[model samples]
Structure formats: C-alpha cells, structure tokens
Target: MHDGIVVYPTDTLYGLGGDALSDEAIMKVFEAKGREYHKPISIAVSDPDMIRAVACVDELAEEFIDQFLPGPVTVILPARTILSSWLTAGTKKIGIRYPNHEIALELISRFDSPITATSANLSGGPDPVSLDLCTVPYDCAINAGPLSGIPSTVVDLELREIIRAGAEIDAVAAFLAQWS
Candidate 1:
C-alpha cells in the first residue's frame, strides 16, 4: 500500500498508518477513519532515532521514553520542521508511539519510516481490539488476533501533564513524578 493507508496491529488496539510525511497519505488516513483535520494523529517510530528525526526530545521526554517505550505510551513532543502540518493537525506538538508488539514493531521497522498510529475505527467510535472490528478502509490489514483493548496513555512532556488516562497511566505518572 504505497502512499496509502494500512490497517495494522498495535499493543493496545488495531490502528491505521501511512507515510507520516505525506499529506496525501495522511488525508487518506483521516478520510478512512472519518477523522476531522483538526484532530491530530500520532506516529509510530521503528527506533529511537526515528523519534529524534520527527520531534525535539528533552531530558524528561527522553527519560520517559527510555523507561516505557516499545510498550503502551504516547509521548507528545515538540514537532520538528520535517513533519508536515497535516501530520501535526495544525499543532506544534505531535504524539508519538513505540509499540511493544513484535508484529507492529516489525511492520514499522520494515517500512523504514514513521507511520501514522491512529486507532483504526470510525471517528468517535469504540476502538477496535480485533482486526475485524475495524471498519475503516485500508489497503492492507494485518490481523494479530485481539489486542489489550486498552488505549495508550498520552503524556504531554512540554506541559508536564497527562492528556489521556489509559492502561499505563499509573506507571507513567509515577515515572514523571520523579522529575517534578
């Protein structure tokens, strides 16, 4: 699915991804999910260097990432110039995920580029835990049975705040608290 959207598995739930830097691909992801342009999408990075390529990571952010990456945390960081405004959803900050699942990791690593990490479901719909539960139109689908059915906990390091509470909130909170 070159320059197109693909439905794949994540640690928490099924997700849809495309080229993070391609506005066209980003549009397809938004269109497929019925997501509004104003709603920002997170990106999945194959490795730590990929994260550095897209975002400005500070000591706190790096520490947090090191502590719980490749797990279930979405760390929001200051956007770098390389990412398109569409990927950032007109914001200066972007959410990032380093999935723990091997299938998801392999997909991103093999893709050799960052891909969109938005949940694969209609906008405002329940997040899908299984591939069949995802109704969004994607060029390819990778089923890995069911997921944890929980969403990733989102942390905005710049604000030193927890944006969304999810499966790993407690652990993230405890880790971030040490920095304060």
Candidate 2:
C-alpha cells in the first residue's frame, strides 16, 4: 500500500502501518487511530541495516538489538535526522521493532522502508490480536488469523529502562539487569 496505511499482522498484534518517512501517510495513520501528535509512534524495520539507517545505534543499543530482536521487543534509540519530528513526536528518540512474523517482515522487506508499527486500534483501546479487533481504517489488510494478543516490550536503550512491559518481558528484564 504505497502512501497509504495498511492493517498487518505482527508477532504480537495487528498493526496499522504506513511509510514512516511520508508525512502524508503518517498523518493518515494518526487520523485512523486518533492518536495525538505528541505521542510518538513506533516503526517496523526488516533488518539491522534498516535499524541503523533510522536510528543512531550505539554499542549498548547494538548489544540490545543482537540480544533480543526479530521477536516481541521494541528498542528506543536516538533518532537520525532523516526521520521527521512528527514521527518522533518532536523527541530525539524513536522506537523500532523488527518483528518475528513472516508477513510483517516480508511487508517491510518489500516496501524497502520502515513503516509505522502502532497497534491498529483507537488510542487507548484494547490490543488488536485479530482483524476484527482493529478499529482503525486502513487501505488494505493482511489477515494472519489471531496474534499473541500481547504488544511488544518497549525498552529505551538510552535511558536503559522498560518504557512499557508486554511480551517477552522476563527476557528483556534479564538483559537489562545484566547491563544495568
């Protein structure tokens, strides 16, 4: 879905995705979810190269990515100048996800760019584990049945803290414990 938001399945939950670099696509995503501009949205990348392109990944962040990626984890790091402030909500940091699911990975790989990885639901609504659960409007959808019903465990590598606990939290905690 070029320049349009799509509903796609991830390892944890269904997501509303659009081109992360396109302000038009990003705004459509925001409108679909009714999410505030101040609240930043996470992005999904296909691999480490994409991650490096979007964020300023340091040694610690690299270790964290190596330890737990292609799974249910979102790593927050310093944003590169390429990303728009709207995408980062005027913050210097951005959250990234490299999902383990095949459909999600393939989508990003084919798109050749990062896409918004926010849950496909109204802001503050329940997790979207299945197509029916998603309330946000999208141009198209890739149905992969139900997901894990859990969101990714968001970790801020710069702050070295878990922003929000979700899937695979124990492993994330152990990783943080070793570093912290």
Candidate 3:
C-alpha cells in the first residue's frame, strides 16, 4: 500500500493513515476526511529511529520522548526537509506520534515508513473510537475492536505548550511545568 490510505486503530482512536512521504497518499487522506490543506497532519512512527528520520528531535524533544512517548501523545517538533510540505501544512514543524498499540506499531513496521496519524473521521466529526464511526474512505481497515475514545494530547515541544489536551493531560502538563 505505497500510496493507499488505511483505517487502523491507534492507542487513542482509529487513524486515517497513508504514506507520510507520498503527496498522493497524503492528499487521499485529506480528501477522505475533507480536511483543509492548511491544517497540519501528524505522523506515526514505530520507534525512535523512525521519529529521528522524519523530525529534528532536539535534546528537549529527545528527553520528552523518553519521558512520555510510546503512548498517547503527539509531540510537535522542527520538521526535517525529507517530509513533504503537504504533510506539515507548509509549517516548518511537524507533530509525531509513537503509539503504544501493537497493531499500530506493526502497521508502521510493515509499511516501513511513517504514516499520517489523523483521526479517521470527517474534519469536524466526532472522535472515531470504533470502526462504525470512521466515516471515511480507505483502501483497508484494521479493526482492533475499539480504542480509548480520547485523542492523543498534542504538545508543541518547541513552544512548550499543550495545543490540545487529551490523554495524560495532568502528567504532560506537569512535565512541561518543569521548564517553566
């Protein structure tokens, strides 16, 4: 599935995934969700090595990853040129997820690259915790029963702020508080 979209389960919610490096695949994801081009999409990586390949994980980001990753958190960091501008929405930063779900990890591992990690629903739709709520077009679906129903917390590591609070808000906030 080099340039195809897939609906797969994540630790938090089902994600509409596609090749992060493929403009065609990324566009398909956006079209499937009816998401605007200006909105940035996050990517899911199986491990730290994949994270480093796509993003510029600074010392602080590295520390943050060590502390809170392999879980439900989206860490925003400086983008490496290897990623398409379409994926990052022309922003020089990118949000990355290292999910704690086995199926999610296996999907990325088998694909051998990062995939778009946006929720599998319309742009303003409810969180898709189950396959019935996906409401999007995809080449394949990996129904892992149901997810946690909450979305991953989006933390901008560069600005040291939580853009969107979801899972582990208290712990994530406390960790960021240390920098303040």
> Candidate 2, which segments miss by more than 4 Å at Cα?
none
Predicted structure 1, TM vs. truth: 0.97
Q: Of the pair 1 and 2, which is ahead by TM-score? A: 2
Q: By TM-score, how accurate is candidate 2?
A: 0.98
Candidate order by TM-score, highest to lowest?
3, 2, 1
Candidate 1, residues 1-180, lDDT tens digits: the string is 558888899999998989998888998999998888898999999889999999999898788878899789899999999998988878899999999989889998898889999999999888899988898998989989989999999999998889999978989889878877
After TM-score superposition, the amount by which residue 67's alpha carbon in candidate 3 deviates from its true location, in angstroms, is: 1.0
The digit string of per-residue lDDT tens for model 3 on 16-48 reads 999999999999999999999999999999999
Better of 1 and 3 by TM-score: 3
Report the C-alpha lDDT of model 2 over 1-180, residue by residue, as the tens digit. Answer: 778999999999999999999999999999999999999999999999999999998999888889888999999999999998988998889999999999999999999999999999999998899999999989999999988988899999888899999999999999889887
